[model samples]
Target: MPYITGERKQGLLLPSSIEDYINPSDPVRAYDAFVDQVDITELGIQTEPNRVGAPEFDPRAMLKLLVYGYSYGVRSSRKLERATHHNLSFIWLTGGLQPDHKTIARFRRDNQAALSNILKACAHVCLKLGLVEGNTLFVDGTKVHANASMKNTWTEKRCLESLKDIDSRIARILSECEQADASEQGNPSLVKMRECLGKQGKLKEKIQGVLKDLQAGQKNATNTTDPESVRLRSNGRLGVGYNCQSVVDDKHGLIVHSDVVQASCDSNQFSLQIEKAQQALGKPCATACADAGYASTEDLKKSLDEGMDVIVPSARQVKDPSSRVKKEHFAYDAKDDCYRCPQGHLLRYIGDHKQTKSRIYAVGDPEQCRQCPLFRRCTNSDQGRRVERLFLEDVRERIEQRYLQADAQAVYRRRKLRVEHPFGHLKQNLGIRSFLLRGLAGVKAEAALAATAFNLVRITTILGPEAFVQRLAA
Candidate 1:
């Protein structure tokens, strides 16, 4: 049997076309058509006519290259530069123009705002295609590794210790220099010592600046490599990264809103993400579902007040393991504004605890509880059995009641499917586990591009290349 053979170097009589190299159904073609139809001005791409220096490449082409490159998991500027030269699809997308790595990197770095606008534009396109159901959004956050290294991160105490060590070393070196200078003149060791001193001085100045900023309450932890990156606990490991939050629509699992935050916890991000999603969609979200991490009393109350139906489990429901008596065991007497304990003891409401923002309700007589046989099983505190209810506990209770209903639970169950699928695809399929850009702004830009690419792929999947091209034409 003869093995199939192919020509390594064959001369062609007819001229080869970059267009013919790519198929009509190729997603790159769809992306090219999409970019051509969209207004570059809305994407914040610079399109001014250049009369002076060398004529600049069209921003539209550069954006198309980036969107297409990122869609295929080519994130590095060097790799993208290489792709333009070697990859036929990229050649077709860039129209035979190969911008250097520096140009590509600068475009990404300087146009973070533009990249975010592009993400919004992609979401708007999804909305127009009926791919996104703006009425319902599933909100969640994932910890994506930053471009910084955890080894470069320092706590306040570590910085202080480092500064102290630096000061001591400088003092010791200066004393040694003074002693050596008295012993010998114009020594090579003295010159090396002076150089070392200068280096240490500059380092001291940098550390001191960081310390000053930290003392002034500007930052929590400092990372010398990427100052904007925070040291967060992610997936049972400590790392320097950003908390990327996304609001995904339920209809087609399209991302409607996304943001990169420095906070490790997502408790305070619920209202902010919901508001942003509403603004992006130009309408209020009928319902928002999230995990227990976003179940803060303040945020839940604020979301409820804004007429957003928020479905989130309590922190205990998701995290707590102890099988202790639950708050539901206590019966509330609305008429008397008191709680009845399991032993039929009336727990009267004390003064509101302003610091904790809760109404303190405790058994009226501690003596009776102390004498009771069940005291050992119930009262762990010396002050007797007490229950603290949030001032807006009713709002949370109402949500919990609604969540108990079959329909609300069904909607809540869809949260994981709607929100986690995109994250899994980005991390596992596209290799977006860590960001290639440093700082929050750059990370946000990378995330925006990633989301745009994901949305583009999704849109192309829903509408084939020809149909998508027709949509773009329309």
Candidate 2:
């Protein structure tokens, strides 16, 4: 068999054009066209037709380069700068202009607000293209690693210990400096000791600041590298990262709203996400679905009050291992406002627990439970069994009832598919396991750019380059 061969130094007779490098059907062209049509001026990008001083690269070109680079999973600014020189797609997108990595990094960092607006712009485009229905939204959150390292994170106790160690080291160094100065004049050892002391002083200052924040109850743990980043449980392990929440429209998998939060859990974030999604869509979503993590009584009530049909599974109650009779086995008598146990015992309402906002109901007579034949299987406590119902127990029961319906169950089943798909693609394909930028603001910008890139790719996939270009033009 003959091996395929090519000329080592092939020369072109005619000068090759950058346009000739990529086909018109290439997605980069669509990306370029999309950027060209979108009003990035609202994103704080300059759009002057001409400049007087030293020539500046068009903001549109930079936007195109960044968006196109993110879509193809090239997130590092340095890598993108290199791509501008080597990659034909990047060359075509930037029109042969290669901005340095600092410029690229600055563009993303300084335009954090604008980057978020760009994400909204992309969502608006999706809506305009009739790709997003904005009727049903799926809310979910995933932990994305922050730029900080887990090793850099410190709890209050750890911070105090570290500060003590630094103080001891400084004391030892000061003692050494005193000895060096007394032993010899103009000794290098003295100079080295002073330098070490200065370095330690700065570190000590930083640690003390962190300690102050901890003492003030501003944060639970502090990351020296990224203060806004928090220690969160991710992928079954503790890591320094942010919890990224996203709301996806059911019409397409496009993310309508996204936010980066320090909260480790999603229970309190339900209402905020719904409000953001509704604001972004400029209309209310008829239904919302989330996993059990987002199910909280306050959030559930808020969702219902907002007129959205929420489909979130309630938290599973802890079953007593020794007893077979679960809370569900108890039957409530609405007429008498009491619960009847499986053994035919009435648990009358005693009073309300104000702290827990639950009404307590316990068996009126404990001696009757002591004499019952199923006492061991029913109540292990000497006070007999007790039941607590929340003030909003009726609302919870109504939500539970709705969750069991065929329609609600069907909608809930699509939650994982709609929500996880974007995260999976972002992590597995785009390599967004950890954020390139530091701080919450930077990470939020990075996330917005990533989401915008994902939406662009989806748009291009659904409507090929030509049609996508037409849509942008439209």
How many residue pairs clash (N, CA or C atoms closer than 3 angstroms) in each of the candidate models, in the order given?
Answer: 0, 0
Candidate 1 TM-score over all chains jointly:
0.93
Give the range of the ten consecutive residues with the poorest summed lDDT in model 1.
317-326
Model 1, 1-474: lDDT tens per residue?
999998968876643777787888887888998788777787787677856778877788889999998898998899999999999889989989999999999988888778877778777777777778798889999999988889888778878998899999999999989987999779999999989999999988988888887788767788888989888998799999999999999998888888999998898899999998888888788898998889887888888898887788887666655555556778988899898888788889887999878998998778878877777777776678888888888887887777778888899899888899889889999899999988887888888888888888888888888888887778
| 1-474 per-residue lDDT for model 2 (tens digits) | 999899969975743788888887998888888788778888767666775778767888988888888888999999999999999889989999999999999988877777777788787788888999999999999999998888988788998898999999999998888888888769887888899999999998988888888889878888889989888898699999999999998977899888999988888788889898888878888998888898788778998998889888887532235446666788988899899988899999999999778888899899888888878777699898888878888898888888889999899888888898999999999899999899888888888888888888888888999999987787
Cα deviation at 147, candidate 1, in Å, is 1.6
For every model shown, what is its TM-score relative to the native structure? 0.93, 0.89
Global CA lDDT computed for model 2: 0.86
Candidate 2 Cα outliers beyond 4 Å, as residue runs: 13-16, 46-52, 171-198, 317-325, 333-340, 344-356, 361-386
Q: Quick one: best lDDT, which candidate?
A: 2
Candidate 2 to truth, TM: 0.89
Give the winner by TM-score. 1
